[model samples]
Target: MSIEIEMETTTMKIYDTEGFPNPARVRIALAEKGATNDVDFVAVDVMGGEHRTDAFKAKNPDAVVPCLELADGSHISQCTAITEYIDGHFEGPSLTGETPKERAQVSMMNLRAENGLLNAVGAYFHHATPGLGPDLETYQCAEWGNKQREVAGQTMSYLNEVLADNAYLAGNKFSMADITAFAGLAFADFAKVEIPQSLSNLNAWRAKVAARPSIAG
Candidate 1:
């Protein structure tokens, strides 16, 4: 069955810039929800400063990608918020979980994947390397950025331990946490932050997640 949400799916539009980690998270979630074909997907040229333009800023004050526009023209930014909305509003394979305890655990694991892996890799790239633009890159600190790379490595070890006994990041079920972790690892690869070969569990988890059609999107 197709995913069902409170809002009209035909009127939903997703503003996204492909290949980016955050936007990929939303795309994967949408795919998993079986809502990809229902929504209008607008691809913004993020590198071309399309996201920084005044018109885009009006849609999302943060001026980032993966902004979800509802039928009323209202927008929702941030991967976690957008994914949470999709998971709750839509009816399909439950990415967040059905039970209260399951939801809490999945949310917690998702946060860990987002902050510990994705954000850390992002910080390292945006700060240590040539960032988006001069206007945004002025505040970057190479030293701090390098430190975040180390932090990302440490987090990988911790996550490996978490996955050692469990099939997925949140537990047995393949949830949003797994998606975030997959996105994070992909981002890390883009940023040249290689996942240590020593992390066997995480490596295995990566292969499993990558095989999913949602992740391939």
Candidate 2:
């Protein structure tokens, strides 16, 4: 479906790190939208605490990657919000659904991917493990992190079941939900949480999504 949306007047700068799932999600959305050339990509040294510094904090209070800096000096943080703006501003494939119902369904599935899988993996990674460093991971909770690993695994199975009928996470077409789910799976891999090989449907779906040029590094 063709969407008629206004272009963003502001110059776009993407602050991100290489190989990070959240940053990769934004890159995938940009690739899908064919808007990669439209913005200046800046690599932030996440491991060097570049994102945690006061200078970076002024740009993004959350101190997280994949933050979009607009020409008006406003910042858009979080993967979903950035993708939504990019989808509406650029002329290309729509990552979020086009219509109201489509948008609602896509947003629903995207949240499911976030809370059920992505956040679970993130909790496990930060709480259960050493994370970035001692200075950063001051409140590590091994027990809570370990529990989230199991939660992530369970969510993966649930996702597998959902994908059994649908071609993508939200519906037949590729959307933000799929990008979020893919990022979640990548996070799981980093967290050492394995998806069961017995879930053939999910395995096939993973392979299919992996083949997409948008996800290709």
Candidate 3:
């Protein structure tokens, strides 16, 4: 199903670090909208503290990657907002949702995947593990991180239960929720969080989402 009209275009740019989970979310969203080629990808020196510099902070106060720069010089940060922009600006299947109820569902599931899986794994990585080394990881909280690791495991089981009834995280239709959950699982693997082998439905769903052209290629 086609979405919004392709607007009067310009060289939109995305500042990100390739291969990172959050960046991958925006990248997949672009591919889904068929606007991957249209946007200019500007690499960020995240490891060297480029993302923390004053100029970068001006663009994104949060100092995170995958920030979108519009033709009018406005900036949009966070994967959710960026994906929403991409979904509405380009013509393709709706990523957010086609209706209000569906939109709410997508948003709800996306948050669960993000907080329970993605960010949970991230906390463990940056806190419990030697994430970016001492230069970047200025703070350490092994206890909190270890607790979040448990949260991640519990969330995976909950997701498995949800998947037992629905083909996707939100429902039958693929939406932003699926994308968030997919990226979350990738982060989980990177963080060395054990994915329960018994979660057959989640594993099956992961394989299916991984096969999509936006991800497979």
Query: Between candidates 2 and 3, which one is better according to TM-score?
Result: 3
Ranking by TM-score: 3, 2, 1
Q: Write model 1 residue lDDT over 9-48, tens digit each, in one string.
A: 5568899988889998998998999888877889999877
Measured on C-alpha atoms, candidate 3 has an lDDT of 0.94
The all-Cα superposition gives candidate 3 an RMSD in Å to the true structure of 5.9
Top-TM-score candidate index: 3
Q: Estimate each model's TM-score.
A: 0.92, 0.92, 0.95
Q: List residue ranges in candidate 2 displaced over 4 A.
A: 1-10
lDDT of each: 0.90, 0.90, 0.94
- Model 2 TM-score (2 dp): 0.92
Please give, for residues 41-110, the per-residue lDDT of candidate 3 as tens digits.
Answer: 9999999999999999999999999899998899999999999999999999998989899999999999
lDDT of 1: 0.90
Worst 10 residues of 2 by lDDT: 129-138
Clashes per candidate (backbone, < 3 Å): 0, 0, 0
Root-mean-square deviation of each candidate, in angstroms?
Answer: 5.2, 6.3, 5.9
